[model samples]
Target chain A: MIELFSDLFSDYTLRTVAMGAALLGITAGSLGGFALLRRQSLLGDAISHAALPGIALAFLITGSKAPLVLMTGAALAGWLGAALISSVTNRTRIKYDSALGIMLSVFFGFGLVLLTYIQRNPDANQAGLESFLFGQAAALVERDVFVILGIGALVIFLMGLFWKEFKVLSFDPDFFQTLGFPVRALDHLLTGLFVIAIVIGLQTVGVVLMSAMIIAPGAAARQWTDRLGRMIMLSGCIGAVSGVGGALISSSIPGLPTGPTIVLIVSSIVVFSLLFAPNRGIVFRKYREWKSGKQLRVEAVLVDMYTLAAQHLSAEYPHSARVLDVMSSMSGPARRTLGLLKDLGLATQLDAKMWSLTPEGVRRAELIIQRQFGGEE
Target chain B: MEYAIDIRDLTVAYREKPVLWDIDLQVPPGVLLAIVGPNGAGKTTLIKSTLGLVKPAAGSVLIHGKPYADQRVNVAYVPQRGSVDWDFPTNVLDVVTMGLYGKLGWFKQPAKKEKVAALKALAQVGMEDFADRQISQLSGGQQQRVFLARALVQDARVYFMDEPFQGVDATTERAIVDLLRDLRKRGKTVCVVHHDLQTVPEYFDEVMLLNVRRIASGPVGEQFTEENLRATYGGRVAFVSALVSGKK
Candidate 1:
């Protein structure tokens, strides 16, 4: 087992697979922050599916899997799709969501038909092309890793260079447009960058699952914090972990698709954060509300007892309390609550049966009653 | 002297359907102009066209005697509240700083001067205390105030606001209007897309009544007559007036 582990690490193919997925994951994670914030999570799905014709056209022309040709074609097609969505929405009455749905299906369908044709032709080495549909990260070559690294570096550099524009456009586009900031041009540029990230992801996560890579980590990071800078950084970290985890799990076993496995890993992180994070998580919010509600109810009961004791002006009374002296209704918990209040020193037991308010308890109860009467407002 | 903003025969369309037609208007400097109209009356589209956000099918707009594209640095815009996602995990300070992004250009971060400007803008809008709060936690009025602060940070000569008072509390509406008055006093030109007709004569010195066409434009004393109001609002006025009268 030790020898096998060493062999796996040293093997060029395995190393390539790990490196490629890691790079794609990091890039997707970085860009996903903006897409998620812009409410354009489906943009990745659109771009990834749109890259199909580009990949097929490249293969048809070159008769080989040349990374540059395929990537350039994919980027062009993706850019076209992004531009088409914008133009169609701007010029026509069709909503952006409907436009995207139309573009995604049409492009993917066309690509699939072309892919089938290529597979049936005389000259074909298209086995790897199908891997892009579900992603076989275990089969990544060194060239694939290089492609991922180069594209990832370009994306990171562009993000840093245009960080301010992206922030402005994403936050308040109207202000950017008024400033004559080339809003449409900058938008197209960013869309181009988004397509680059999605295309890079396509080779690792496949078309159907790329949305998970683009959204899951960002969504998870969002639940943990409310700062954009921190969320983006955390998203990148989460993406890196899942990328490595997916590669490890798939490589360890046969017939496990890497794309779906990676999605599962990222989704689990989201689920964990959603349930367990301290401030904004679902479980924590519900728990806090429950605990606070109990405290409020107890406070109400103590205030009721104090009001009754005030009416009597009695220094001593039996521990057992009656309800009619206080306003109207009473329940079982009210009685149990009075007993607990006496034990907590909020109330005093006198003559072995009745209940009276402590000096401190009387003041606290008076404040609560005043608040309930709208005195504070 | 050139007017603050001027449009000549400005006709704009979406696809082939005309949205704004034959609009000719001139706004002087230091004037608080309110553009009022019913829903889908091209209130937003007019602002967008002047800001160069949309291409006009015909005609032209000039700012400070030059086209908006040439004077881009001198203009600031505050969009409608609904245009942005409030749930975005950005703090008030972060959103305010976005104004400087356009002036600072690409690749450069806002400097000390820019930070001071942003904080000053936030202070002007009375949002300084909530500078670090997440945008989602803000009330509708506070959110509008934050966007105003963003426009303020631009330090531009011309400011255009789209439905700035929408969903704002009465106090917030008062505060934002006062801020606009302050801007006008400082020799800045402020144009707002206003929805409430009752506040028209009280809030704005100049008014532009629109209904996909240039119905009228001038000071409230001259152009805000019943004829223009009728043309702009159409039959909806009878129903709207009932609600308007019921308020007082």
Candidate 2:
């Protein structure tokens, strides 16, 4: 690990690839947060897919494989895809998802045809043009890293600038407009930023998996916090970690592509969050449900003992454990539930088959019964 | 005297279907008005068009004496609570602070002053203790109150509320009524898109009965009558008061 760390700093190509990938992660992760919250995850998919045709068209038109030139093309086409989706949904009765599907497939299909055309042409300059599909992150030069840095900074800056407006717009656009905001223009600005974020990632993560980078980081971060600012910041951190981790793992391996490796890392993060993150995690929620269910059963057993003791001559009289099984709703064995109550100091095990409510447990049972029946009045 | 809200020759349409037709209204300052009507009565559409949220096919809206754009800050709005996602990742205080976005304009963050104002507004709605609570954790009535608190921080002369009492508990309903009366007492005009016809006369001094077009609009005692209600709701309402009053 120490040797790898030193090599990461000393090796120029590995360093460039890591920086470029990290920049993509940070940009896509933060902006993807807005997309996720707005329930516009499909927009990212459509935009990235639409970027493919733009890349091929940019190469065909300019004949130069300059990163900036191609990225500009991708940005424009991606923006056009989002705009077309919005307009189609507005102008027709077709649902927004269907419009997104139409634009995404159409642009991507055209892009594939153009890519095939470029490959068939007898031009040696088109050597690495195919890498835009699955992104050759290993081939990212220092210039590409610099471009990602500059553009990523600007994207982050713009997201910070419009933080308040975009948040309100996502929450409630009608109210946003009523506040005298130009809702349409601001919405376009945010969407334009999404296009830029996608364009920046298209060269490194590639079109096929760029949308995953845009979506998964934010989704993973969402489970950890309840505030948007924290969610975005956490998402950026997750993005950076996944980017560096993917770069390291792919560099160590013989033939692993950085794009898919990074996607797998981010996917692992999402899966981990879904299963184990506090409060919102599936495992945590199930554990809480089980714990509460157990507590309820324990309390049920204690209360049944108290009720039976109330009917008898002496408060110290023990109730048979079988009586608890008859009165309680849950299917927990009476002895086990009584054992839990004893652990909680709510009941005393008088014998092998009988139990009695303790003073504290008696007080609690009366309070519960009072709340249950008296409150209804 | 200038009206607080003045609408003239207003028409709103979606495609070929007219939602509100060539309507005219003049609401004076310092009165709590209820725009009462059945579902699809264009009540929300009227408010949206007046606020420039939706385009009006024809006509003009004047806030105080000028157009809506010039006098934007003088207007406050509380959209339907159901219209927003309560599960959104924000705290009550943050949502309330969004009201100051109009005054702060573009690119400026909400400062300490904005937080103070938001907290004060929350106190006004009796939600000061829930400032840090996640919005998703809020009950329906608490969500409505938070929205009301947000509008309070807008500090506008005219407040437009869409269904403030819908789905709220009885205590919240009374509290909203009290807030409306307080706004009236402060010389602020409040217009609510109200659905509960039974509470119209008791809660509002001015009432507008609408169905596609204005059926009747004036003081509740004079305009909110059985005849106007039957005309507005089209005789299928089955209201007991209408039957009792009609017999009288």
| Fnat, one value per model | 0.83, 0.87
Query: Which residue pairs show collisions in model 1?
Result: A317-A354, A318-A353, A318-A354, A318-A355, A319-A353, A319-A354, A320-A353
Chain B TM-scores across candidates:
0.94, 0.97
Tell me the spans in candidate 2 whose CA falls farther than 4 Å from its real position. Answer: A1-3, A251-254, A330-335, A348-353, A370-377, B240-248
Off by over 4 Å in 1: A1-11, A121-124, A299-359, A371-377, B226-228, B235-248
For candidate 2, the lDDT comes to: 0.89
Q: Which candidate is the best by lDDT?
A: 2
True contacts kept of 1: 0.83
In CAPRI terms, model 1 is classed as medium
Q: What is the C-alpha lDDT of each candidate?
A: 0.82, 0.89
* TM-score (0 to 1) for chain B of model 2: 0.97
Choose the strongest candidate by DockQ: 2
| Each candidate: RMSD | 3.8, 2.2
Docking class of 2: high
